[model samples]
Target: MKKIYILILSLILLSSCKEKLTEEQIIVNQNKKTIDSLTYIRHNLHPEYLKSDNSELVANEIIKNCFSVLEIDRKNLEAVKDLAHFNFEIKNYKEAVHYYTILIDLKDDLNNRYVTFYYFQRGLAKFHLQDFNGAIQDLQQYKNENTDKRTIGYSKACYYLGTCYKNINDQSNACDNFRTYAENVATDEAWNLVAGYCN
Candidate 1:
């Protein structure tokens, strides 16, 4: 009985030690994976390498890898922004909306000019996703804050806002936004939209 007790106690000690080692190893492995992923992105998705023929493929891979990392660490804003931008660039509007939504909620600093840009991009994503009301809200928010009417962003926002309003049967608001867009951008498309929708 004494020998059996000693063996059991020793087994328990070894088990506890193994558990501790396993926990430490898990953390170390996670850190190593993060480092490896960041390094891979730096090499494969850098601006210099992005001009290559395989840039789109490389960007898709990076987005996949970044999403995995983001799953482990959702608060990584860089990963979130990268996912949002890459998805937008690839015209994966659904994924762009997902990441931008996450980024908007997680982002701490919203006082800069970039805040309007984020709203505009997210609005466009929502527009592509067919969430017209949500798109209107986001685009309107951006329009309210962005004072530079000469910017391409402002024109796009107005155009999309008009589109969103028209889709939702808000013809009055649609006409108003279409007029604003036409006033800011003297393009044939803008004028045609204003004529067709605003009249």
Candidate 2:
């Protein structure tokens, strides 16, 4: 009986060591990826470094870090979302898309409103990149989900949808959307976009 007890204790110790090793490996890998991302971003933004072609490298590192951190600490959705936005600011649209996609996927898991804002932000980026199909897709998704009738989101969606239609020469649809935006927002920017583009 004593020998059997000792055997069980040995097995427990072995399993614990394996778990610790796995956790340590994960931590080390995440740190390395994060360091790589930070270094890439710094070089890209540094005035003296001017000629780096590391956008793909930086994007990969950020996506890896964001995904790994998310697996461990999903409560850090805000941090992950911000990192995604940082990608967008640098015109790293693919990276931005990846991050936002993950963020939206984890919305129920994180129980956060991040996806709402990202919907709009990603829409704008897609629009500027002339991914008109993608822009319309995201904008329409946002408009469908956002039920805040008293806020500005509804109106912005209308304006963006109008812009998307106008870009594609769907003037009739553009006019309808512009009318909706003008009715809801009444802001200078929204009004100007409508006036300049709509017939």
Candidate 3:
């Protein structure tokens, strides 16, 4: 009788452990399915294909699907960034700012380079939305963190920072950044800023 009671207790403990493992496995499988669906959408939905009238509807549907996935899994960085870029391409600057803000808030897990890109893009979106001071803060953060002054991003940040300052009537800082941008990049836009504001 004693031996039987001990055996029954051991079996009960084993069964409880197995139930816990099954619950964990179910959660893992659900997460995997969500990730897999997101991956499929990302692979199939190129923003370039959205330009044509014929494909615009399909592209919008794909964007909706991406949004759905993002709603469920907010930490999916690639999908978030893709959505941000897509919004920016479509001239939805406010939406781009929203998505980029999400990415910016995830500072702990992201690389510095990616964080800088987020700041740059978000700053551009904010500028388009007429939030000049917000734009300046993000653009300045990118400039301070990014070491490579030769990249197009650096020049663009400088140009925009200069423009933001000019808009706010800060000619001194405006000319300073615009001059730096002109010295490094010779784009038509940069030259226009130099002629119009920096001079």
Q: Which candidate has the top score in lDDT?
A: 3
For each of the candidates, give the backbone clash count: 0, 0, 0
Candidate 1 ranges with C-alpha deviation above 4 Å = 1-33, 39-56, 109-111
Q: Name the 10 consecutive residues with the lowest summed lDDT in model 3.
A: 47-56
Candidate 1 residue 46 Cα shift, in angstroms, is 4.5
lDDT by residue (51-72, candidate 1, tens digit) is: 8787678778778878777677
Superposed on all Cα atoms, the candidates' RMSDs to the truth, in angstroms, are 4.2, 6.7, 3.7
lDDT of 3 by residue, 52-116 (tens): 56455555655676776666687778778877887887778998999999888898888878988
What is the C-alpha lDDT profile of model 2 across 98-198, one tens digit per residue? 77887777878755465777787778778878887788888888877787855688787877888898888989888888988887877887677677777
Q: Ten-residue segment with the worst summed lDDT in candidate 1?
A: 103-112
For model 3, state the Cα shift of residue 115 in Å.
0.5
lDDT of each: 0.83, 0.73, 0.84
TM-score of each: 0.75, 0.60, 0.76
Best by TM-score: 3
Winner of 1 and 3 under TM-score:
3
Instruction: Estimate the TM-score for candidate 3.
Output: 0.76
